[model samples]
Target: MIAANNLSVNRGGRLILDQVSFQAKKGRMLGILGANGSGKTTLLKTVTGFYPYQAGSIEIDGKPLATLKPKERAQRMAVLSQDEHVSFDVPVYEAVALGRYAHQQGLFAVKGKTDDDIIRKAMEETGISDMAERSLLSLSGGEKQRVWLARALAQQPDSLLLDEPTNHLDLARQVALMEHLTKLLASRQLTVVCILHDINLASLYCDDVLLLKNGKVICQGETQSILTRGVLENIYGTAFHEWKEPVKGRKQFSVVTRV
Candidate 1:
């Protein structure tokens, strides 16, 4: 499990995070939801040790985040960034194999049979095996997203942290990615902590959610229970109406517009 206790970060005379606390448990998808500027991305980055926190602590499976070595951390957590616009001049298989870098002895280490198998398995899991010999630039947006996801999965990390993984995808691609995540959660014991902007998407995909407003947590708990219309309005400072989505019976939002 990944836990953050009283986490806080200050920057340029402003507090980006204020005593944020939440747990992303094993075999669950925890969606971090908030309005823009609510510090959702900052919190994810801090957990990855990319951004420094001024106060509080982050723990992975009861071990302090600060104590883990770089390779150790990489082995435990794999992050997929929203802006992962890679221009790497390599085949899909080679790009996915890059996820195994931490396991290699040095920069010149070659892929062993096990590494190749893992890489191929990851691509197959993400449904990108056919693109193995293809270049990243040749794939479409949705295909590239799967390649990136395959790359992250090849890390074989127990925890996956995604920063708006659906950012540049079309509607169908978004559903496809989220649907695959749901299947992965059910099939494995992996933990997912995703930062999502779409309220309906979070409601549809997240098992639980953490709501934030102005760098402070509004609430965090089961998605269906905590994501009521009133709660969403309070967090976003706007009027909203709730309705059940016909397909899955999940709650969806329709913002009340004053025109």
Candidate 2:
């Protein structure tokens, strides 16, 4: 489990994240929701050790984040950034194999049998096995996005920190990605903390949600309880209509849609 208590951050003499706190448990998906500049990204960055904070503490599986070495940290949690620009072209398989770096010793690390097997499994899980031979630069945005996810999976992490994992996918693929995540969560072994813009998607796939406004957490809890009309309106500063989704019975909010 990953938990942050009373976390605070400052940049350029201005506070970007204020005493924000939340927890993501194993086998559960936590969605971070907010308007622009609401510290949504900042919170994730701080937890990932990308940004330094002034107060509070971060714990991963009962170990403080500061106590773990960089490699130890990467071995436990993998990140799939939204902007993964492949500067140099490489084959998909090779890209995914890079996730094993944390477990490798020595500067000239070669792929072992176990690493190769894990890489292939990750590619297969993400449905990108067929493109293993293809160059990263040759694939489309959606395909590259899947490749990155496969790389993260190859880490065999207990937790995933994703930033807009569905940004490049089409309507159908977006739903497919979320469905795949749900399937992975079924194992009750992985934790997902995703930053998402689509409310309906979060409502359908995430078990818990965190709503942020002006660097503070407006509300954080089960998706059903935290996505009420009043809470959403207060976060986005706009009117929204809330209703149960037809098939799954999850709550969904829209600014202009009706039940």
Candidate 3:
């Protein structure tokens, strides 16, 4: 399990996160929801040890995050950030291979058979196998996102962290990515914590959610409970209405009025 206990973060003397606490259980998807600048990305970075925190602790499977070595931590959890700026002109397959750096021996080391197998599995898992030979610069935004996801999957970690994984995706790509993620987590028993702006998507796919407002955790619980219209309104500062889908009867929340 990945957990944060009384976590806090500050940037340039300004507080970005305040005593945020939550637990992402094994074999479950935890959605982090909030309006822009609510510290959603800040929290993810803190959990990954990318940013320094002013207070509290992050624990992964009972081990304190700060105590783990870089490679050790990467082996345990993989992160896919929203602003993954890959300026290189490498092939898609080669970009995904970079995810295995921690597991590799030297800079000139050739990929072993196990590495190739895992890369192939990750590519197929993310539906990017056919794009393996394409250059990263040549693919569309959605395809690049899939390549990044495949890289993280190639890490073979127990936990996955994604920041806006659906950003810039078309409707079909978004659904495909979410569905693929759902199946991957369930079948592989991988713990997931994702930062999602789409509340409806979060409610549809996540097992639990953590809502944030102004850097503080406002609510945390099962998707159906925490994703209510009232809570969403409070968090987004907008009036919302809940409705059941005509075809599936699944609940969906939509903002209708400014608050």
Write candidate 3's Cα lDDT for 1-259 as tens digits. 9999999999989999999999999889999999999999999999998999989999999999989999999999999998998777999999999888768776687789999999999999888999889989998888898899999999989999999999989888888888888998889899999999998788778999999999999999888777788888899888889997676556798779644
Alpha carbon lDDT of residue 250, candidate 2?
A: 91
For all candidates in order, the CA lDDT equals: 0.91, 0.91, 0.91
What would the per-residue lDDT of candidate 2 be over residues 169-196, giving only the tens digit for each residue? 9989899999888888777479999999
Candidate 2 regions exceeding 4 Å error are 257-259
* lDDT tens readout by residue for model 1, 1-259: 9999999999788999999999999999999999989999999999988899999999999999999999999999999987778766789999899899978897799899999999999998888888899988888877888888888999989899999888778898789889888888778789999999899999999999999999999999999998999999988889998999999899999999989
Q: Which residue pairs clash in candidate 3? A: none
Error of 1 at 169 (Å): 2.2
In model 1, the clashing pairs are none
TM-score of candidate 3 versus the correct structure, residues matched by position: 0.96
Where model 3 places Cα greater than 4 Å from the true spot, the runs are 246-249, 257-259
How well does each candidate superpose onto the true structure, as a TM-score?
0.94, 0.96, 0.96
